[model samples]
Target: DGSGFLAIFIIGMFVGNQNTRKVSYILPVGEGITWLAQISLFLMLGLLVSPHNMVHYVVPGTIVAVVMTFLARPAAVLLCLLPMYFRRYSIKDLLFMSFVGLRGSVPIVLAMYPVMDDISNAQLYFNMAFVVVIFSLLVQGACILPVAKFFNVYAPASVAPISKANVGIMLNDDFDLFNYKIKRDSMEGRRLRTLQFPKETAVVAMFRDGHLMKPQGGTQLKKDDILSVIGVESDEIALNAIFSQDKPVKQYPLYAGDKIYDGHTPMTLLAETYNFELTSFEKTLTVAECMSYHLGGFPQPGDFMNLINARLVVVSLEGDYIAKVGLYLLSEIRLKEHRRKNARSGVSTLSKYGQKSLHR
Candidate 1:
């Protein structure tokens, strides 16, 4: 009752949530202490149990371990997670969790309490607990990675930096310094400028074979090179996508002169990035869908639509679907005139060039 474990757990939860910055400073020290404590715990447990005594209980302990691993643990996981089925928990996730119910040092330590209190057959309990722990480690632990793989509950490999240093400055919360090691061969022969990173993201420093070098736009990326990048926090996803080999990178097209977007580009992204207006319902549509809707569901190359102050002209098509669109902003005088004519007409109309007016 007075073990202080519950108290420590409560304090840890409180501090972790309330003071994350302070907690980060102590993480390295806490990890070192945790490793030391685990080593000491196993050593102490090893000193208490004799291999001769453990041998007598091995058969029964193995049976108990099997039952727990195959039946009891799985049933318990199913019952607890069944209410969350489909919404938050999936069948494969539940199955994997049930299979990986590894018994740890806590049970062995609890077993010692019964023996110390002089309970009936406490030595039997201690020996059984020891055998169960050993069985769980040797059998269940060994098979965990294979089971996880079989369930497809694994993340693709990513290269983490060898070192990180936080740079403290004004408005630091909005920005971050990321150091990534280029481990994949996909980016090995590509130049830095060709990678199409996010606008606010830049690679500032590069190190090859332990020698620091300045990174230029034309510098080619090589495997095992460590690069220090500085970018805003929102650019993290785009940066990760650029570095990832297995995942497809989402394209972030610019709104500069003569730039065209693929048909698949989201209209909502365009509106938000370029200050274009869109209705709540229209926000869910893509550029191709909007253009096709304006053109009466049959769009061809060079067909244009007048959307607010910009003209969206279909540039190309992949079969019947619009594949590319070029955007051109109207002059201030033309935009005012277009709006005045729409207000006076009080009806949706099509122009001579087959351009639909979406003003109303």
Candidate 2:
């Protein structure tokens, strides 16, 4: 089935959806799985290539790889992204995504025959494939984010699960939360406001023994609180710094009656409440985003479709205070359930956090 292009188109839609301003964080498990699948394919194909055979075709294969990564991939991305109406994806994000286009397992498996069977100049074919793969990995992997910024698809800052040993608790088909177990006795009793992290991260919620912690500043801490946080891919470094510190996290001063809730404000302002960005901002919408939100992907509290009791109480007739509270509250509930189900099987609620709009 030439459905390969169709599948790619669909995947692009999903990836583009996650790049939107309100929802852009990818599922940690899915992201990791993609890498795993790619690697597995590569390994399977590696058995097919012999060094002598690969060396000959190396140069031509590199040319093909470069063309695929630089030209074909970017063109596909532009086709998929242009309709979404994004303004942020700069030349950089396009360039980087294009660069990282590794021809992993599928190509390897397909290449096996050329290496095994005497196709004219077998070594040349093998070598070129190797060269292409290297170019994809080295040039592209090295610059994923920088390119994201250029493409204007770089995600917002917030707490994120460690990519290496990440644990995502799927609350249901719609929502999920990524978990990182903070070592016990570290940062015990510290207010949520005290954690030191970069602007590129957010601590969405916390948990203990699988029970969700209130997404509140006053929420006290205990050993082994399983923190459920949301952040862009970049915030991982800062997240590591905060959790690794472990001691009573230094507290930031809160003025009298200071509330973290800011109404329909710039993402930068709203994001200050958590350790990361409130949502990854994309100026445009793609077909996948429309399908995911089911209401044409408007970025308002009203857009938060099913937050139940959630309300977007506008502080100044502008902010979706209701949606904000709803997200925070949902985050709390999800955190608790994740804790209860930590060692057991449970659905993940992280994906459900923002689908509800609080226009009411």
Candidate 3:
């Protein structure tokens, strides 16, 4: 990457072929879209506000919002959405976005400024805004799920839809994310670990129905569970091939280990073999796969003293170990001493962590 600046000559269009690079396109796209949305908002708001009879139409205003949310929204939902229903903004999605027009942090303060100025009908404006917000949230938020079900727009596990990808890493390394829809009756009741996985592969994450799963060896992949797979460079093509194989497994997987992962990947191998616990707390743990180039090596322990005996464990940078290992070793020693001294008092907390690790 010494020549990182050299790669800028190619147009962005060619680079967006990959998800990680595609985001470079998306961020600007999103900003432009946001800017456009803001511009449209100002224009529309300026056109819609009729202060002359504002107070006189408070009731009608509320009624308009209700009608818009309940009638106009569902109408738009069934029309623009149903034709290409991959995961149609379910009733919940619409309900949340439609009615939950948030005033946000700034809006609350700004709405109050008019009151401080004591502008005529300022209180009414603020109060109306507050009331509309509350109604949108209360009435709309409450019915999100129900309306989703009613419209059959609610996300179902059976559909096994592919969702948008907003994951993976760029730790001075390449992270390619892939998504695939499992076919019906193809390979249900089967575990993915036993399958033919790609070389240099690392499946760091998996998602299902808006939930993040901590995947494991026995985590059987099911139909409709959107897989968020991350792999290094070598395996990218192989992963793409597997996802597009002649016949993808069809039967929906029944076993659910709760922990999510594609175990055939290098990530699972490293995690299961090394006893290294990857946590959300640690950001560097990201390079989704096990590439030979980035072993980056084992973690090393730094200087830390055990207060009980003031015992010391010094881990050197040598032996291909991570440099920050000693501090954790010391912490572990201290924790063990604390547990031994506290026994029953702190046993519950330590025991829980131990149990969870064992499950992993």
Candidate 4:
């Protein structure tokens, strides 16, 4: 009744909500403390367990363990995760999770309470709990890796830095410091100047084998060298590509306005950029001029002209002229409809433009 579990849980909730930035610092220390506490708990519980008494209950205890491991735990896991099946969780993943639900020191610790209270047959309860924990550790724990492999859920281990510390600088919400370790035969033997990092991102510092070094453009990167990079959140994908063993894929950042072309932009350039079909006559005109010709009147905001495989929607108006136009492929329209059906709130942006389509 006086267990500190609830109190500690409440404290953890408060700290997680209020001081998340400090949690990273607390984790390494908390992990060490947890290991020590688990060791002490098991040792104390072991002293109370009698081999002869436990042997008498082995058959029943094993039956309890078998029912819990194969039936109860799996049913509970399936029930809990059934609702999330649409979230890309396959049957194999759920099965693997069910099998690996290892019983640990908590049950034995709970069983000790009745013994301390001098309840009748409390020693039997403790013995049963110890057997369950031993069975779980020896059986489920040993099979975890094999089950993961059978489920095709095992992934190749990636090389990670020996140590990482968040700088916790509140500069810009979009920008932060990222740490990367140079992989062997990957980014190693390359100069910093040769790396094609995003223009907005830059190397701020370098650490080699636990020693701090100033990062310079001419400095050669070595295996296991840790680099502190300052970049926006979007730059992480490109950074990972650069540091990975595989050839980097070209990445382009598209802004919301990129889909909406300026009305003053040349029709020929837009046609070439998006591979839109344009007649020789239409290529000579600007986007606004072409749209106005097709409309046969003044173009206002929310006017759209259907193209071969895409639709051009007028985004905004400057006086009587089209100011901005959005291009949406037929596939994109269907995708947006699917998202709107699932999310129910994704149509706000398109709804602002009204329901006007111009067919030529």
Between candidates 1 and 3, the one scoring higher on lDDT is 1
Candidate 1, residue 349: CA error in Å?
43
TM-score (C-alpha, index-matched) for candidate 1: 0.60
lDDT of 3 by residue, 1-360 (tens): 356535643444455454464465566786687688656644544453556756665686588558755777556655554544456555445544443343323344555667779899776666565545545656787886776576555654443225334334553345555665655544443445444565445455555556565443334566565566655555555555555444555544332222323312343343454345645433234222221112222211221222222222223334333222211222556666645643432112222233444345
lDDT (CA) per prediction? 0.69, 0.49, 0.46, 0.68
Pick the lDDT winner.
Answer: 1
Residue range 219-306, candidate 1, lDDT tens digits: 4567888879887556666667677774433433322225688999999988876676776777788999977765553454445666
- 10 residues in a row with least lDDT, candidate 2: 311-320
* Each prediction's TM-score versus the true structure: 0.60, 0.40, 0.30, 0.55
Consecutive 10-residue window with the lowest summed lDDT within model 3: 291-300
lDDT of 4 by residue, 1-360 (tens): 765988997887776554345666677787899899899989988888887777788999999988887788778877787877778888888888777764786797898998999999889889888888888888878888888899999865654434445557742243557798887575655656557777677677787768676543334577888888887656777776667754533333221233878888898887777666676788888888887777544443444555544556666778768888777665667646634652332112221112222122
> Comparing 2 and 3 by lDDT, which wins?
2
Cα RMSD (Å) per model? 15.9, 19.4, 20.3, 17.6
Rank order (by TM-score, best first): 1, 4, 2, 3
Q: After superposition, how far is residue 345 of candidate 1 from its true place, in Å?
A: 44
Error of 4 at 146 (Å): 1.3
Better of 1 and 2 by lDDT: 1
Itemize residue pairs with steric clashes in candidate 4.
none
